[model samples]
Target chain A: MSSHQAVREGAKQVVRLLEKFPEEKFKYLVSFKATQLERFSRIAGIPLPKKLATEVPGENKTSINEIKDIVNRTSGPLGLQKDMLRKMQAAIPHDQFTESAMKDQITALSNLVNNKYKNYYDVGDKLYKPAGNPEYYQRIIDDIQGKKKENILAGLRTVFMGR
Target chain B: MLKCTARKSSLNTVTKLYGINAAKTYNYNPVSLYSTTNKNLQADQKKQTELEFDTHGSPIVRGQKSTIPEYKLPKWKEALGEYVIKTFGLDMDKIRAGPVAGSYYYSICKEQGLQYENEPLSDSAKFFYEDLKLPKTFSQWFQITALHEWMLFVRMRAMPFKYGRNYQQKLVDKTFSDIEMRLFDEMNIHSGRIVDQYSKDFNSQLKGAVFAYDVGFYTDDTTLATAVWRNLFGGRKNIDYTHLDAVVKYIRSQLYVMSRMSDREFALGKFKFVPTKEKINKLSAQEEEEMKQKIIKKYEELDKSGLLLPSDKSNLSYDN
Candidate 1:
């Protein structure tokens, strides 16, 4: 086969391999670093592709920076801290413990109990019912808020409290 | 109306649609006929008013300008005109999409970077110029505007090929027209040759930037950011990483929203840029489904009402 045809055939093989990849095997690949993979290939005495070693600057950094910058910019108008603004990315699995989920819960809970505070006692009305434990929800909220507050203070402390 | 029929029948033998009895129709000019009748009427009135002769002349009217009567075709003729145009298989939707995609879309893109002397910047203009810290020069404005035009072109390419090509042509035509006008008025470049040179330079830059952006869009964010840095930021060394990141995010969000838009909605010029200040969260699958249903219902209702003209109708999907 020609080189072009060989490349196409190689690509088709890789796609077939990916389709057969198990979740457990994929999990290992997720945790596998490039250095580890290189070490494995060396031990196996197989040469690796040149492109495998190519490091594109800001390739992986852009997504994190994009999310961080967007959260930071949006926080200013929403009267929230940068860490508290969860974007609730639709591309990912919904985690109720995420910042965005907490914010939604607080808003919904606040409306149901008709109190401004997003806590357990305010939700003691007849209309409100705790699915499992009321304090459980409260603890999650408190923990997230406490951690976020400490983060903000630490950020501030570094600026005000010099090394 | 009779005068129109008379003129058409007398002027052309092929105008059988006007009337069957061409010889019976008066061949005189209506203006001259009306003037003679008016003169006769004035003479008779003068004779009647001779008994009440007064010293005061005709009253002078102030502020009221003379109004000319406008001719309008009858409903049947108007419908017939559309019917004839349609029977020839002219693409009406493509013609209508021109103004919406070209003039309307270009205005949206232009306003993003538009600045006036001795005036406050608009919200988007402030975002690009002040917040992003780009220079406020005319060339800089063109860069910002061209970037936005490129984003719209990405969505325009998703449209059916023929209509999309026409839309692209109209938009480029409008871009050049506005640039020429600005050169004369805003830049005060009175010489034709100098304006031509500047336009040629901008045209070449636009072509290059478009190709680069297309490459970036198809590849990855890194390439896209590099393109933005080179074209929009002029490859300056003092560029802020945060600004670059924000612009990339902005472009991605705008593209995401546009990718979700149906062809009919986009063709009708319903797409608006997501403001920099607002966050566009990804719509849940349920929300997207609901949105699709709403779009389908809206178009169905409009179609059922039969309010849209032949020129306004489109074959593009509203539910996609």
Candidate 2:
């Protein structure tokens, strides 16, 4: 993807990740090392969502108060810290998210967020032998030329006949 | 009704003299149940089934799972109704055996996707399976399976404790591995990576989606309709609520179809699953009459053969 597209998608991902991330899983982020927290801030390229997480450069020991303050803060327009405000903490630096424990989960989620187009070229990466994924390549060409006639007919049948 | 009674009596005579009607009465082994006896009755039963069970049937409603709790056929209606069900050729027992839930759990993983193209929709309607525009790609195939999986998962939630838990474990495991395998084979993700990455993410999303989606099923119509709109249409501002209304109708239509299916019909994996966004429309009186006539004709062969239930064609309630 172009840098511009990546930036746009990445911003959307951040919003979604905050909205839908597991609350319990993200609680670990509050206990992150001072350096790890800074790394997260750099990646996000923004100040921490809540004011309690003041930027501390290169400090070996970041105060746990940073996370505690944010978690304690109430979400506006509602007395409770619910909705987006609650889950944004999940974006905080947490070792468990990057470790092998959640490694597969990260790749899967990242791929989903990337909306990586399922291309003909990708299939050839692993299945490349003599002809590679030539069959897949041909199928893609057929699909593009025909504009997926098979699916269109399938849709028509489903509509009219309730198949 | 008189016509059905005459056929019922006549069917008994044939049974006593020829032992020909034995199989359908047993409600087992639907395929072998009808080598002869009444060829046209089989066609009639399928058509009637499509209407009574598939078209008009609704979801279990409220807490019922998969099917309504009990049919409670009225005493006066029993003889005729039984005859109708039998004439239609159900053999509910055989359909129940299905493919055997865990027979080849690991091996059955990752269907060739559009695998229905290989089987007929039923013994009749030879053309039904043909030209379904089966999913050509793995992802498209995933969508088909995903729809069924979602429906089944929702139903499982409403099931009784023991069976509900058991079905949930078995179905979820089978579905996930199949999807994981699809990623490995078609998308060519490394097998190792699939377990470490894709499976974990997929599981989380599956849980999130199920929770988000099933709420609509458990709630009232308006909530369900809105949920359907947001999920299916991406909550686009330009799309009208009429489209959502159509979707709600289509969902009820499919659920009605599911409620009507025998266990074998469901578990045997022979149903269609592509999206039907604009497929079904509200029918006019003329069209309604036309549909009724067409369905009625399907049973004519059986009626003429004197196997119809109750007493006759006129006695039957064609539309309730």
Model 2 alpha-carbon miss at residue B310, Å = 32
TM-score between model 2 and native: 0.30
Interface RMSD, Å, model 1: 21.5
Residue-level lDDT of model 2, residues A1-163, one tens digit each, is: 3554444344344334333322221121232223322433444455554532554422666554565666566545245455665564442323322223233333433432232212211212122111112233233334434655556776586456432
Model 1 CA lDDT for position A51: 48
Query: In candidate 2, what are the lDDT values of residues B23-49, reduced to their tens digit?
Result: 345333356336577777666545332
Model 1 chain B lDDT-worst window of ten: B59-68
- The i-RMS of candidate 2 is 21.9
RMSD of each: 27.5, 25.4
